[model samples]
Target: MLLGAERGAGCYAARVLAKRIIPCLDVHNGRTTRGQQFGRAEHGELRDVGDPVALALRYDEGGADELVFYDITATAEGRGAMLDIITQVAERCFMPLTVGGGVRTLADFRALFLAGADKVSINSGAVANPEVVRAAAEHYGSQAVVFSIDAKKRPDASGWEVYVAGGRKATGLDLLEWAVRGQELGAGEIVLNSIDADGMKTGYDLEATRAVARAVDIPVIASGGAGNALHMRDVLLYGEADAALAAGIFHSGQTTVGEVKRLLAAAGVHVRLVQHATLGW
Candidate 1:
């Protein structure tokens, strides 16, 4: 029975693992893109890298712990196709998927979850209707709700301000206050996407990430500005985030999930070594 007790301890240790590595896929007009900045006042150069499904499959096969798909368009035309893409990716992927972009109401959250998304991430919509998060959590459980907050540092304030519509519009809300409010509204997790550091590869905005993580009890996923394994480790360790989400670095073949995990292990961050499985190998 002592051996059984030891095994149980190991299982508990695994459940408490720190620093998850999540790969992000930015989809624009039904195709995958890379190196695209989050905040653009007008149309920006969005270079199509490949198909979303193809890229997601590669990340899944490369042992990504989770996958996030963000649609970067702002029109009815873009919305219809984005759902179709989500459906296609969901049908093929075996891992948990989180989808965001243009999700405005509890109905939107329900539709996305019904389309096979494990979680629905709300950004602009949640800001518009703060009650939507609570409504979603009430109906779909807290685990199914995620608040994606895109923030840019305001010159007048010491903290960041929330931005929406692909970071094209600034809401002037205090980042810390909004994070606290999101937690109160029953958001399961928070995805703090940094507009200032996005596509810059300078490393994550640790100050912003840590502030939100410290303000809320839910898991915070740091998005944007991951250039390498060290960047991931810095965010997970110093930023106090539960997970680090990257796009360009991973999509461009600059870093692999295994390499990041090994580096984190060396830094005393607990991470699970996931095995990738491919169908019909």
Candidate 2:
């Protein structure tokens, strides 16, 4: 089991202990949008934020360590147009990219990887067929396959439950069990998104996140409920996540990667501090 630490322990542990700051871009109908209250199972307030390629370039310039592009409508729409956007962004942005949404088969994963995505995140598809995780890991290697679980706390139940179809459908699978299964199937990373905490910006659902993190051996990314730099730090340090992914706070110019790093440094969390030219301001 990985020992949970304060802000600074992991940075010098020879384990590449730096926490990742990932900014998520939710594209719907080819436009950027900000969803409210967990960004799950609901439509967001859409913004015609020009082209994805342009925004991706801006984030790259703004010192983002990594980028996540989620085609918010792809699964519902039953198409793969997000691949075009992923290709466009990957060609222009010189950083790692993780593309999610509408990825159901090995072919879907292959297409995204071929399009230059460093990783592919699958949520709904993996729920529909758990074996998808094993097949993806076999074909693309474990590191390239990311299992994204959107979960919400069940007051009546003892633990959180996984939600599928963009959080509209609930699966009775226990959160920890699913997480362990994904790891056993050779998943390189686990993105545990808290449906209850998403978009609320109260900070990440540390309890739920910690449960999953403790269950998995690979890197775990805590998503949902990131409002400020402190929230990011809290999640990384307290939740024991390898990374924290957020959308709204960064999208509306409420925070920048540089600022987030500075805050993390003050809190003693180890993060990559980069100097870059500012954009869009």
Error of 2 at 179 (Å): 0.6
Tens digit of lDDT per residue, candidate 1, span 1-281? 12111222333234435668999888876777765456332456676778889998888777677789888764222363266777787778766788888888777876777676777788888888899889988877777778999899989758899987787788879899999999899987899999889988999999999989899988899998998999999999999999999988887888888788878888889887775454221
TM-scores for candidates 1 onward, in order: 0.89, 0.89
Per-residue lDDT of candidate 2, residues 173-194 (tens digit): 8899999988988778899988
Task: Quote the RMSD, in angstroms, for model 1.
Answer: 6.3
* Error at 16, model 1, angstroms: 6.3
How many pairs of residues collide in each model? Answer: 0, 2
